[model samples]
Target chain A: MYMSVAELVDAAKKTKKPIYELVIEQEMDTSHNTREEIWDAMGRNLDIMAAAVKKGAEGEGVFSKTGLTGGEAVKIKNYRSAKKTLSGDLMMQAVQNAVSTNEVNSSMGVICATPTAGSSGTLPGVIFTLKDRLDLTRDQMIQFLFTAGGFGMVLANNAGIAGATGGCQAEVGSASAMGAAAAVELAGGTPEQSAEALAMAISNLLGLVCDPVAGLVELPCVKRNAIGVGNALISADMALAGCTNKIPADEVVAAMDKVGKGLPSTLRETGLGGLAATPTGVRMKEKIFGKAVDAKA
Target chain B: MTVNYKSVFDIIGPIMIGPSSSHTAGACAIGRAANSIFQETPTDIVVHYYESFAQTHKGHGTDYAIISGILGFEPDDSRVPYAIGLARDQGINITFIEEPEDSPINHPNTAIIELTNSKDGKKVTVAGCSIGGGTIEIRGIKMNGFDIKPKGPLPILLVPGSEVDQQNVTDQLTALTKVNEKKQYQSAKGDLFEYDLDRRLKPEEVKELAKNNTNLVYL
Candidate 1:
């Protein structure tokens, strides 16, 4: 199996196939499943993602059980409609969708975990936004998932994807890198360009810790997904514009792994550091769960 | 250590109801794995949460997730949010205990569940950890004084009963698919034969094996 971005890009180039096609071929070989079965499974995931985006962006805002996160996505949508946004419609739409998906997740709604649930919003945000802007076909959108999953596999294997294991750098950071790489491919950029996008995205989010407020996937987690989409979009555009990273994608992934490991346990989803330890955060946790429970780092 | 991500889906999806994959989906998956070994709905359960799970389970809906999974609900099942009520309706009693954060545990997200079957008065203890990305590792199982620790991520089959013919079951499984690993443990209650297979056994295959081995109480 291809273990690194270099290997994946090399195989894609040699076979004269896009990264998504190579990913599909590898999945077929490893799973021993028919191509139709694999494609149909991903199609199901796409349906879930689309449904979540629609529910979050258009439906009445859903509140989390904790009452910590809700309505922000709708607020953004209304704001973008009423006022001119500084980031333009595309970026704001992605940001809206990203926050919306995370809100849905925080409310215990069904979502396809793009690498992981905490980081699920970024990919769907980028994908659905591209669909609206690029008028991408259903198959192309599924291809976007495959391309993203391809790069995600590399990061997951080489570095990590769990917030508890490697902080938010591994969760939302990896998701952003995957989204950026997939965006490059969806825009018809070369594998090398995809790698550059992936590298740039990871480098940008390096050392981003995982400190969810109130030990819930709310607060900064939802907003961070919005930021992740913005980062991915900018990185993809830069790669498409011929920008490259001094550090390779694989090395960046390795660097993220190192940085994540070096981070204190308090910063790695323990809810004991960062914003989670803020007085308001601690008070919120007490109000929701009672003060008797000591939230250990 | 590399995870050897086998499929694109492993990275892209595990369509689930979630606030957190590790806390909710992975916790549910661990419950499902334990339920599979239990072979039936448990009448009573006591779950011990450790470290991170102890700290954040309520916010993540991990209690509901695990209960729904033990009720045979998938991670994405809509019934998950109502699992507590459903469990109560089914006359299943559940108690949750939070272990101290300083408890000596290998993983931060860990749960040790003890399941009791009212009909047979059988008790099984399962210890599992959420390693992340909606994935779980069944670290150990304790049944009738025998402890079984599985080593890898491969699909596992357990055949537990009195005087189970290990060779016959192994032969049957070998005929159906490759067995990567096998262990046989003898306890006062029965002989527990476990096999780690190359892939998950199909329902028909499981049925065929059980039909052939009368002593195979769990598969």
Candidate 2:
């Protein structure tokens, strides 16, 4: 198995194969599944992601049970339609798509966890947005997922992709890095450039904490996904333009692991610190779950 | 260090209904694992949520997810939202208890489930932890006073028939794939044997085994 980004890039360069092909071969070797079976499974994931993006973008806005988060994606779409966004149409469209996926997730709709459900929106935000801009075919879209998965596997194994384990930097941060790497590949950058994108994306969000307000995957979580998408896009662009990270991608992942482990427990999805501990956050929690839960908090 | 992630799908998928993968999808998977080990329709089930699970069970729909899993629903099943009412309709007495804040559990997202088949008075207790990314680790199982902890999250095949059937089942399973661990226990129902395999069995292989051995249980 390709356990590190350096190893993945080295193998890709040696064999003259794209990272996605190496990942597919690794999957086939470990899982004992044929290429067709693996492709079909990833195809199913793509369909799910597309359905979620469509539902979030076009369907009636959904509200979570606690009413903490909802309708933001639709609101963004409406605002984009009525006025010119400062972030430009493409970036705003990506933001809308990312927020829509997370909104669907908040309302308990089915979503393919890009790495984890909490950061599900970021990768799809990058994928679908690029699909429209690049006019990527179905197979290219599938390859994008494979490339993302390839990098994600390394990050998860070498660091992690769980907020509880390594804070939001590990969850949304890893998703962003993976998306950036995949975006680079889809943009016709080299494997080394993909690694550069991955390193830059992760290092940019290295110390980010998992501070969901009121312990819900709303508030900062939904907005962070938008930021993640933007981070992935910008990093991908930089990598494609021949920018490089001083630190190697594998070392950056290791540093992220160290930083995440060093973070206090409160900053690690415990719901007792950061925005979750803010007065307004506590009040929102009380409004939804009632006053008794405040004592526990 | 050992790599926990094995496949691309492990990183990208497990299409699921979720607000949180750890709280919702992982909890559902733990419940499903416990149900699979239980190997029978439970008349009564009591779930004990600890730590992170207790803190956010309501908002994340973890309670509903766990119930849906115990009802044999997959993580992506649309019916996960209505699981509680469905359990009630099935005449299953389900109760959820949040452990006290001071309760000492190693993992943040842990759940202990106790299930009983009221008709036959068969009982099983399973403890599992949601270890993120829509994955779970079945910590251990308690049946007839024996605590069985199979290695990690390997595929488990439980057989509860007779002492003679143990050798036959083990032989059959060993021929098909590598058996990592095997244990035997005596219960009120009969002699129960457990086999943990190094890898998952193919659907056809499971079907063939089940067809040959009526008492075979695959988890």
Most DockQ-accurate candidate: 2
Model 2, A1-297: lDDT tens per residue?
A: 788898999999999999999999988876777999999999999999998888877756877777888888999999999998998989998998899999889888889998999999999999999999999999999999999999999998889777877899998999999999999999999999999999999999999998777778887888899999999999999999999999999999999999988988788777778998899988888888887776754
Which pairs in model 2 have colliding backbones?
none
How high is the TM-score of chain B in model 1?
0.85
Candidate 1: Cα lDDT at A34:
78
List the candidate 1 regions with Cα displacement exceeding 4 Å: A294-297, B1-4, B101-105, B159-193, B197-219
Per-model tally of clashing residue pairs: 0, 0
Per-residue lDDT tens digits of candidate 1, residues A72-156? Answer: 8899999999999998989999999999999999988999999999999999999999999999999999999999999998898
A12 Cα displacement, candidate 1 (Å): 0.7
DockQ of each: 0.59, 0.61
Report how far residue A74 has shifted in candidate 1, in Å: 1.5
How does each model score on lDDT? 0.85, 0.85
TM-score of chain A of each: 0.98, 0.98
User: What are the TM-scores, per candidate, against the unseen true structure?
Assistant: 0.92, 0.92
